[model samples]
Target: MYHAIAQDIIKSIMADEYTTKLPTEKVLMQRFDASRNTIRKAIDVVFRHGLLRRVQGSGNFIIKQPANSGTILNLSIGFDRAAMVEGGPLVSQVVTFDKVQADDRLAGQGNIAVGTELYRVIRLRYLKGTLYDLEESYFPRTVVPFLSTDSVQHSIFAFLREAYDIYGSTTENYVHQVRLNDERAALIGVPVGDKTMCLDAINYLANGDVFNFSQTFFVYPDLELYYHTENIDLQK
Candidate 1:
């Protein structure tokens, strides 16, 4: 129930329904028919996203508002190609991880032949437990045969090194807007018709072998993708 309330308030904030401080806890309790504990928990969830600041003597105040809380994604210079900065702590909630057969489209993405085996993983990324994106990855089983739930819970790159000595990889990134399905919409705190940023990436191994192909869906309103370009003359 608290989760529902939190999401409702978040939706309102996203819609620009409220810019000032939230109503009193008692008022919210009456509005939502929830207990004080539930209301506080809900507010805490919002607070974790840097949306609200709780004052000791007074009450919670807006901290980030809407425009400032969007996430930023980047390609780190030489390592950790998957790093992105969203609001709050970045977390991955594993949805499903299974060994599946790679079809034609999947093979093209992984640079492998059709019918090859691949591990398909779906995860919902959270910023301080608020839904950020829906990430789906296709990893060749031959390349990462030892992939496990524990390894995937955190950073897959780190786990690859610890288990298989696999290191850095070159990545190809593509960005576009995509409409989400109902399931994905619910996961990312948006409606079905709403469009979101989609990042399609393929990572290669040190020896130029294909490692992982991933797609991420981001829903936060304020987001920026950074790219460093050289040799282009601004004077031109």
Candidate 2:
């Protein structure tokens, strides 16, 4: 009975444009002839779902509708490839940008010689104000002649595609689940030993030449990863 009344109250507020204080407990008690415990329980339900936010010395306000409970999509394989599709806002804050020597791991991923000059870029990504993932990317200097912090701030993929005409499509992708270490946890603002998703992807050009490589760690329990394949009929 409380749930039914709560739902009606929520619906009424959502439908109306006027912003007014919710009726006091006394009014609600009279309207529904409900006990104090029942009224409190109804309010508690909405509060836990983020549909209501309480202000100090003020009444509860409807800040937003209840958020969708489940995993958000964490699309990685280089931002360029991911940006091709349209959905939600994709924002990235550059953490580090510098040139570095291609170590064994970097060389193997980019298919380049050790000690080759490579551009390293690190970014933290968010979805609707919630921290979602952290990414570290490496690019061959030969492919991207020059890069600047300002240019990347706008959109790294846009800068690459328009200025250098360097674009990458995913050739291979690897994903796994692992516990976050102290360093990684600190970077993502999560507790140490928290479960996370590790993704490694090798991106190649239209000609099959490797262009970029990346490793991304996503805050799990909030994001989900998926892959889909479809068969096409060439002959019609």
Candidate 3:
């Protein structure tokens, strides 16, 4: 029910129905015939999609949609989904896809037991024919056994959800501003020593097992991190 409400709200936003601020909670509850909790949940769904922002004393405000900017949706579903939300198709060029047994280093990084089999995948992500990001991911074969080249070209998450009914529940990301090496630089069409936003993430399944470990480099200049607010102090 909340998902349906969220879709309606998104549709309305796209149609310029709510351009500045959303209606009050009481007004929304009356309008949708939903409970306050459900309306709030729907608002959270829109917030995660980068469409709405909450002001403390003010009501929910609409965020101006960026012009051809690749948005990083806070949901952490997949890059393909994020691109789809921004009205563009995300293209992937698979660089490496192979099976390997996890060593001590890999196990520690992925929080999986040693000797577990994992598929190592490296891909260059493009938006509208321009290189946008690079991703190197490791997926446990126990969680994802048969990944095809077509899945690698498209979306791994979609393949998992459709094939195995597996979905991403959470992601723990470590953000860093790092300099690109010679090889990484050339792949993403950046100069060596160029600073890039890199995220190392451990993606988990609903059962709480680590499904994937990925390192992604954002080479795009207009990358936005909308999840983080301006006033909140990030802990060290």
Candidate 4:
């Protein structure tokens, strides 16, 4: 019954009902002929679908829709799964995988000291053999001093977990469009005026320590982004 009510609300949303805010909980409970808990649960179902946002001191608001209405790209997933979901020929070519001294730029990005030893890994990602993303990651040597080319050729997240037992690191991502420079444009096979998106992420350990900083440049038109946020509280 709650699911039916939620679906009815979703249909109403499609019909342009409640564009900004949803009805009050008391009203919804009365309309649905359901208990407060049932209405709240139904609303939560819609909220998890990325449509509703509950603001403090305000009512539930309909969030703006993402670009990929047909497909929601989950950020919680890895590149290999997302890049080749359609079962096409996916490729990850390593451009540069070596240890380098962290310059001022790296130090600022990774929150490490200048002249710190870090492993810089750069790889070009493709979907169905068409290039679309350029991934570059920086890991402080103090964290993972040794990495193999084979390990990197597959999945860095897997390698980190299997080798270093690194798990449950918090990831922070920032998304924005950028105008590609001449060199990058040439490599990406796009003109200088073409636009690109940079997804910058920083991984941190459970103790709130920095682990790695990664930046992936994606072709805006060819790819999209999705993220799900959850609140973790131990108290009941």
Best by lDDT: 3
- The local distance difference test score of model 2 is 0.65
Clashes of each: 1, 0, 0, 0
CA shift of 118, model 4, Å: 0.8
TM-scores of all predicted structures: 0.63, 0.60, 0.68, 0.63
Order of quality (TM-score):
3, 1, 4, 2
Selected candidate, larger TM-score, 1 vs 4: 1
- Write model 2 residue lDDT over 110-201, tens digit each, in one string: 67789988888888876656666788888777777788888766566667766876655445778888898897788898899988778877
C-alpha lDDT score of every prediction, in listed order: 0.71, 0.65, 0.76, 0.70
Relative to the true structure, candidate 3 reaches a TM of 0.68
Local distance difference test, candidate 1:
0.71
- Please report the TM-score between candidate 4 and the true structure: 0.63
Candidate 1 lDDT trough over 10 residues, lowest sum: 75-84
